[model samples]
Target: MSDKDSESISDAELDRQAEVWEKIAHRPEFEKLLTAKARFIVPACVFFLVYYFALVVLVGWFPELSKKRIGPANLAYWFAFSQFFMAWIVAWIYVRAAGRFDRLSDELLGEHAQPSETPEK
Candidate 1:
């Protein structure tokens, strides 16, 4: 095939892909997937921010309380350190949630995927 033929083929493929994506975007399943991701992400973000800021606020506003030693380190230090673990825990939760998201995406694509004509060797 010539370069022009190849270019036209690629352009046609892109156009078809766009059309398919447009259809998928309008699908209820796609909306549900978006909603589910938002539902988890929005609250997770809120919780993380609140927890992170609460530590800062406590340290700033109530230095005496924050200075109270737990083991060798103070409450502020412990809280700051715990943010790392909190981040890891949130990431773990998101990974678990993302499995469901992947499943939903797979199901959506499975429905939408065009059957290839003559399997490539």
Candidate 2:
């Protein structure tokens, strides 16, 4: 084919791809998944930020938490220990929320399916 013909073919292909993408983007299932992801992401991020800031503020405003103690340890060290517990709690909360969100999302997006029937052993 001539250069002009090849260029026209390429342009047509690009337009076709764009149309296909537009259709996919407008599909209900795609929108639902996007919404679900946003729901999970936004809350998780908020929780993480709030949790971190709370710890920082607590340590900054509470002098007892920063005081030194025996055994080369300080109040900050003990407060940091408590922060580890907070980390565990946050992690657990995130896992539970993400799992529940995933299950609901699968239902909403019509991605989950039951297993096939099987005979007893």
Candidate 3:
């Protein structure tokens, strides 16, 4: 969406799109997508932040936890590995959720896009 693209649209078409956008804002599917994304993203962000904060605190205040050896590697190594694991898990979750979001977005666009306003290959 660019200013030039919007500028090419007639006032009536712009108004129509605005109305469509307003309706899309109220649509259950759009709302559901938002809620679902928030549910996944908020927790994931919080979990990552907490993990990061804990790591900082542990390394700063308590060095013994990171020193404890689980195998050939220490607890710090395992913690570092867990960060990578958590990142991969979040990426996987986002990729899965993105498909759902795209579907919902396409459905919304289908309801709104006029023949000319819609892109043509």
Which one is best on lDDT?
1
Q: What is candidate 2's lDDT per residue for 51-78, written digit by digit as tens?
A: 6777677678977756868467886776
Candidate 3 per-residue C-alpha lDDT over 1-121 given as tens digits, one digit per residue, 9 for 90 to 100: 4546667779997787687567757778778778877888898889889987887787778788889999889888788788888888878988998898889788866875566654432
TM-score of predicted model 3? 0.72
Writing each residue's lDDT as its tens digit, candidate 1 over 1-121 gives 2244445556677677567668768789888899999999999999999999999899899989999999999999999999999999999999999999999999987876555621121
Candidate 3 stretches with Cα past 4 Å from truth are 4-20, 115-121
Better of 1 and 3 by TM-score: 1
Residue pairs clashing, model 2? none
- Residue 95, model 1: lDDT of 100
Better of 2 and 3 by lDDT: 3
Runs in model 2 lying further than 4 Å from the true structure: 1-12, 64-79, 89-121
Q: Which portions of model 1 miss their true places by more than 4 Å? A: 1-22, 115-121
TM-score, per-candidate, Cα-based: 0.73, 0.50, 0.72
